[model samples]
Target: MSRLARLGLAVTLLFALAAPVRAQVKDDTPRNYGVGRVATPGQIAGWDIDVRPDGRGAPPGRGSVKDGEKVYLDKCAACHGEFGESAGRWPQLAQGKGTLASHDPVKTVGSYFPYLSSVFDYIRRSMPFGDAESLSNDELYAVTAYVLNLNDIVDDKFVLSKETWSRVKMPNQGGFFDDDREKTEKAFWNSNPCMKDCREPVKITGHAQAVDVTPDEKTQKRGVE
Candidate 1:
């Protein structure tokens, strides 16, 4: 056999021999590191606080726009103005109905967000600037409803809960669609990449010396390219 063929056969034999050893070692090693216990249902519940668009995982709670306004004024008004107009550099949460297509579009809770669940999830996960996950379930629901009321999306009497969450439709709900780039942009894709001589041979059109960008050869250090 050729020297390269002999080397290849040796490598294959070595790998074949090591395969059983590797499998044995893997089987002998403990899969569990013995560091932490499996999470309790209560612990899992705490971490699984995400609210979905379809109202799945929503906590059983209710909050009225009026109650939300009170909570908003006390907890949220310092940053998001008295009526969700936004204070200083903070985000504006209301009054940008027809401004989306304009040059300076004010993307607030109402004008830009495609889902109410997203708003609820954001507030539930992180809100009041610093004290994240501090609000009660009712407060979270109320504050969310209040934001909707600020945008005129909900009436002052509207009470938001798991029951009514599905009834509320966001203004930009129809703006979002599933990603179809694979289907739409597949025609322009180049799967096979060229590595060698893929284009016309590159010719030296000019040199750095022609543009006077190169240092003087006399000043260049010896043995340096």
Candidate 2:
């Protein structure tokens, strides 16, 4: 071999041998990345407030529809109508049966929400608009019951609690489905991963535009304010 070829081969061999030495070096100096202190149990509990779809993690409380109605009117009626039919630009909380596929879908608790625990979780954490997390546990239960009553799912006398939560099911309860991507789509992905050949560059196609669909800037700023 020529002198240039020999020098190139020697450098490549040195790199191939040095890679293992670098890999074997132990990084035992203890990286002190000052990434905040360890959180306390109480601090963790305050932020860890996620409720399950199966009625788990719900706080204990009871509230009657009668009380719920009062609470709804006093606190929720201003935005949500007297019967949960959103006022003005506010979102409608009830009604809208069988309108999911239509051009104008009116998603409400009665028509869209899948889980009842979601209602409890949402209201308890982010309800009464500006004054979120201000309502007591019992008051939140009442609010939930009242909303259910508006949808005619529960009677005016129904008293909702964490235990009886599972009993309250939305109309479109089974409308959803579990994703079967692993079984149905995994084969498509694993079947053909290699691309050995090239194709001609495709021409640009007509693009679609979404006009008059977005909310105005003013309305966006005052969201549920």
Candidate 3:
């Protein structure tokens, strides 16, 4: 074959290869990562680990407060004291039942958490801090039951599981209200301007440096000021 024809064939082959490279260089568009294919039961079961406020995602296992107490002694008492009082810098998990609006509020699970599902989710995801996901479903339920019992929320024989999880009510459930962001945004946006006429001239009504430090005993002896 002629050299010209050979060069033309080689150029054609290079163009063919470059076509795919050009296609690959296009900008990345957004993709729906979880759109296709209905997840199998096993796959859904593996990642559906979120516990909802209504105890929607609780697993199939039962644990009583008694069982939870044993589990707490073995796995949790080192950090969260024997009765969930907290050992040192760790948080106290119990004994703060009715102090939400106090000047010094001591928030515990019984006093603060609005949902029992949140407590179970937190313990199942990250508790005992160092070890994560080390407890069985039954053990998690037991520990949660024990903690609730310690906080004087649940009865000693209360068993926690997916079926009974939603029935466990918290004390602070009615303390919070829905977000009123529309009113808040309108107030901030429509408020009057305060650039220069915000306040009156500063006045020094009192000064700690000019206070009289002399004893009042001589005034008492005189019986008059």
* Number of backbone collisions per candidate: 0, 0, 0
Per-residue accuracy of model 2 over 1-225 as CA lDDT, tens digit each? 999999999999999988765456777899998989999998988777668888778777899999998899999999999989989999899989889989988999999888887787898888888999898888998999999999988888899987788788778788788998888777677655758645677775744444456666877555484
User: Compared with the true structure, what per-residue lDDT tens digits does model 1 show for residues 35-100?
Assistant: 988899999998998989999989989999989999999999999899889999998998888898
**Candidate rank order under TM-score:** 3, 1, 2
Clashing pairs in 1: none
How big is the RMSD of model 3? Answer: 13.8
Q: Model 2 reaches what TM-score against the true structure?
A: 0.65
C-alpha lDDT of all candidate models, in order: 0.90, 0.86, 0.87
Name the runs in model 1 displaced over 4 angstroms: 1-36, 179-225
- What tens-digit string does per-residue lDDT give for candidate 3 at 80-146? 8998888998888998766777888878888888889878999998876899888999999999999
TM-score on alpha carbons, each prediction? 0.66, 0.65, 0.68
Q: Which stretches in model 3 have alpha-carbon errors above 4 Å? A: 1-39, 184-186, 201-225
Evaluated at residue 18, the lDDT of candidate 2 is 85
Per-residue lDDT for 132 in model 1?
92
TM-score: model 1 vs. ground truth: 0.66
Candidate 1 RMSD to the correct structure: 12.9
